[model samples]
Target: MKNKSIQIQEKHHKELQKLSESLGQSYGGLVEKMILYFKRTGIDPDDLKNESPTYKIQQLDKRLVSFLKVQERAILKPLRQETYEYYENHNKTLKEAKSLINKKIVQADQNSKIRTNNILKEIDKQREALNSICEHLDPANKKGLKTVFQNIFKNAN
Candidate 1:
């Protein structure tokens, strides 16, 4: 489409720019859409010229363009900045938590391996102790050795 320039107030242009961004359209497209809406609603664009003075005055009193500018500068801009900061902090916290979780997982794995190794070592020690007792006990001393083994099992339980 061919582009044409028209004179419009700065605040009106800013409002249009904001509207364009929000609607994801060019300012010209937005204007075209607005015109289409008016046409479909049976409102004649030319009739604006014959509008009552009070209605026109009320339109001016609304100060929508100024309101949009104030909202952009005083409220929206700061809110946007704070939103960015919030995301940054939230992302940082998530990363740190992930790192901590991974570290804990690794530590748990290491602890599990150590516990297994300790259990194996204890088994080996008990086997060696049993072998020593068997080797030391003669046939005549077997009864005493059997009593000692039964007491060891009782203590184990």
Candidate 2:
């Protein structure tokens, strides 16, 4: 093995010595173990990978996204329910309006039919009065203007 020398601050060396004592290792042995750990993990011993705020922020971002998804579902559930209820109420109202319109249409048809029947009855009474006048004018024969008037009245009826 080759010997190498590296200089460190006095305070850092003292801290290293304290760590070495706590670990029940010589300072040089502790340094060797740290170097071995770096070689095995392919990481620098001084790098605060897990303890850095950047890593904690990334974890917090993931948890925040999950929490937002839960909140989104919780908020949308009531909105969806209200939307469904609104449409259902509108549909029922539309159905009621349609039925009312249909009833009005039926009533109008019945009224038109009644009016038509009344007009027909009036026409029949007018024809009968004309026929009675024709009978008065030609009581003896069944021919001439009385026959023509009877034919016209039959066709009209």
lDDT of 2 by residue, 59-126 (tens): 89999999988887898777899999999999999999999999999999999999999999998898
Give each model's whole-structure lDDT: 0.84, 0.86
Alpha-carbon RMSD of each model? 18.3, 8.5
Residue-by-residue lDDT tens digits, candidate 1, 12-79: 89999999999999888899898897778665767746675578678887888788999999999999
TM-score of 2: 0.57
Q: Candidate 1, which segments miss by more than 4 Å at Cα?
A: 1-63, 138-157
Which pairs of residues have clashing backbones in candidate 1? Answer: none
lDDT of 2: 0.86
Worst 10 residues of 1 by lDDT: 138-147
